[model samples]
Target: MEEKYFEISTENLKKFIDGIITDNYEVIAPTDKDGDTFYGKINKFEETNLDILLPKMSYKEYLLPKTETLFEYSISGVDTEVKDGLQNIAGANEKRVIFGGRPCDAGAGPIMEKVFNWDYKDEFFNERFKNLTIISIACEKPDNYCFCTEMQLSPESSYGSDILLKKSGDKYFAIVTGEKGLNLVKAYSNLFTETAKDKVPADKDWKKIFEVEKTKSFLDKNFEHNYFQERFLSCIGCGVCTYTCPTCHCFDIQDEGNLKEGRRIRNWDSCQFGIFTLHTSGHNPRVTQGDRYRQRLMHKFKIYSEKFDKYLCVGCGRCSRNCPEDIDIKEVAKNLAEMA
Candidate 1:
């Protein structure tokens, strides 16, 4: 909100997006790879995976990263191993933008900013977030397992995007939502044209977009759907769902190698696993898969909603799409709503 903003047609939207990426910094976006779609760096507009509904993993990798060297310490002749990690953070360039991201994924950015920048400031994480911009695109179609409608996020929700690109008939209608978004528009004046006809997207009503919101209002009523346990009874305790969910933000930090020369690494973790909160004192908090499954549903719907006033899910359907047990979130929400 600290900068000027504008709206443009989706046709010229990609031109503006590609134009920004064409400048300094390497651009990355989601792309379909064989049967599995992944997010990676790209050079051209044709390679973007705009049609793929969900990515293989969340965009957490861009912020926290899988493996990182916190700081390396060495000894010359014993009693010398401390060094400043911030010695050269400024000299290196950390400029880049992600194009064609989804509203759900981009929305997680600000939500993530809260906890990451809280307690004690993580300069490493904050530094990375400051230099990057996220351009989220609107979802055109809902997947079978998608429950975003139940969670109050429509296809065009723009909670945490620098720029939001809405798809029209053949063109895209782009809207700048942040100062960074405004900077992108102002920086590339040639890529955009001032439209006088109020360039806001026309067909973005929630009642029109959501087919199940009116009929399947069970999602609002089913806070205590007991059958989900029976439905998920076939689950083999795979963490794939939690891993692929865009809003699931639990992780574990680990140290590998010998004690004297081990590197501290943080890896993606899931609550579906029994050991997620295992105490070092040998008392298991969540003893069974049922407890873990119940925790996941309640946390997403009941807990997160109470805390953040927003459902932790974006309804991208990556969990059900990649789930080996085919546990559909839509079916669960519908049944719960119906039972209620």
Candidate 2:
């Protein structure tokens, strides 16, 4: 379908969201939690906190949960019985709408989707993704940590978003970019208008801080460079970077139960962990923090790009913002570009 545009007043936008909630759609939005803003389920539009450019964490958990059960099994004498966990998962068949996410967060969806469907189709990830609708708000005031423009994406890119919204005075210029967005507008036709308002133009002043292609070239040949060892000396192997990253998809699966019964579960894992690559024979591939950090960079810039023809990062800067060592990925990429 061709793209369609419309304008909606702020009042009607609130009503639209409240109506979605009233209709029993699982609404996920940036809401105030503890003292900071995070993506979480909201009961109404009033609970959303859209004052910030990006939330503390992306809405990835709604699609790929932090911990999920693959299946449950029970042992009876010599026979084993299994049960599909998807049948028991809550909200498995409900539609989910993610509103007020930034473009960087929205873009992570397609990047992750590629990985889930590469070698084998991940039904667990696909089911949630298929039911999700992204309504991202364009960035009006990006902070210093933002580098979406450098990653070949803009604040208003609308790459993975169903509907991209840009606030203009008392209304929003909404661009319906996909089938889901068109269906949403058709379902709520009264909330949107065919006003002749001009769509918000992309920011011309948003500069690209580094050339990603050049950085990739440098990483392609300099896998064992001394820069990795010296630059990552401060890394403490905390795995915080991978946990907060929008595009990191590494996970670990475990079976927990006694001889009677048990369930196979998948949990989020990180390459930064010291034992991530440890072998039962007491051998470790990535022994130092530098080696693990280098793996992280290589996976994001070179490995994934070589396979998917796209970078595995959306440049959301959550790692740098939440890192205890204050490591900045943008600076690292710029330094690699300089080296190239």
Candidate 3:
């Protein structure tokens, strides 16, 4: 709290995490079980993993939640009735500390805040965000399609992160961005020292490998372009990219089970699928795979920028990582720019 930046020894990083866990803080980080990424309350700091390279999915799964029950309903006779059962987040009373979130993953939180709170104030999202404190880990290298710079976002982006952490040498350099971040550091002041000059990322420009401007230009010029027959021709229409994208915030609301007893639930959805924009009247808005594919790029570059004045794509390249169809976003962006 003395200065904005503080340093803790690499040796103490795990210990500090353990201490947070001891304080009843739900410490969530990347963990592997059968080579699958799972985030849960870590019982020990040793459970914190930063060596997974790139997680196929973003950390938004924890904050936004994959499924949420709006309420429960039951019918008596002719009148259908519903009762509120869920949608409660004990923010003030609950505390969360999320660690090892990449800049792209962490930055999506603030961007999502606008839409979730725009038309109607979503108390559920706001509560989760308020109670949650993020500690973003700076990325060391750029993935194939990642152009964080295109959106003026970087591996060092401090958007939703309460505490920013950079791995420098054997130590981790940290900075507190909000009151919660400060309190967190203060809670474990003994484990940390005053801001150390030696704890800065040696190669701060490590992300220069990805061409941000080139990617943006490609996206801008390809507004009227359809990537379907070209780059996405081999795409199996799998919604893997949407699931991997940090900024892809689409969900489906469904009422399942019998009409007498039902519940409204929200589940993660993808624009890549034909059913995404399907209307109840049976007229599918985005019927073609090409249209769905183009929507993905358009939403990231134009629509999101128009709405939030910020590009939605974080350039994490998770889409490339998870694409079973071998769709490469970097090549697609570059090809768009080159062809134009």
Best by lDDT: 2
In lDDT terms, how accurate is model 3? 0.75
Summed over model 1, clashes come to 6
Report clash pairs, candidate 3.
Answer: 146-315
What TM-score should be assigned to candidate 2?
A: 0.96
| Candidates' RMSD to native | 4.0, 1.6, 3.0
Comparing candidate 1 with candidate 3, which one achieves the higher lDDT? 3
Using lDDT as the measure, what is the rank order of every candidate, best first? 2, 3, 1
Tens-place lDDT per residue, model 2, 34-100, is 9999998999999999888788888888778899999999999999999997876545645789999
Clashes (backbone N, CA, C under 3 Å), per candidate, total: 6, 0, 1
Q: Using alpha carbons, what is the TM-score of model 1?
A: 0.83
Model 3, range 1-340, lDDT digits (tens) per residue?
Answer: 2337788888888888888888788888887766777556678877767886556678777656789887888898898877763336554426788888777877888888887888898776777877888888887776556766555777777767888888878887887778888888888899887665445555365444444445556667665565554556676778999887877889888888696788888899988887778899999867677778878877876667777777777777888878988787766655655554
Summarize candidate 1's per-residue lDDT along 9-28 as a digit string, tens digits: 55566676577567766677
Error in Å for residue 83 of model 3? 4.0
- RMSD of candidate 3 to true structure, Å: 3.0
* Model 3 stretches astray by more than 4 angstroms: 1-3, 74-82, 85-87, 196-203, 206-227, 257-260, 280-282
Off by over 4 Å in 2: 76-79, 89-93, 195-205
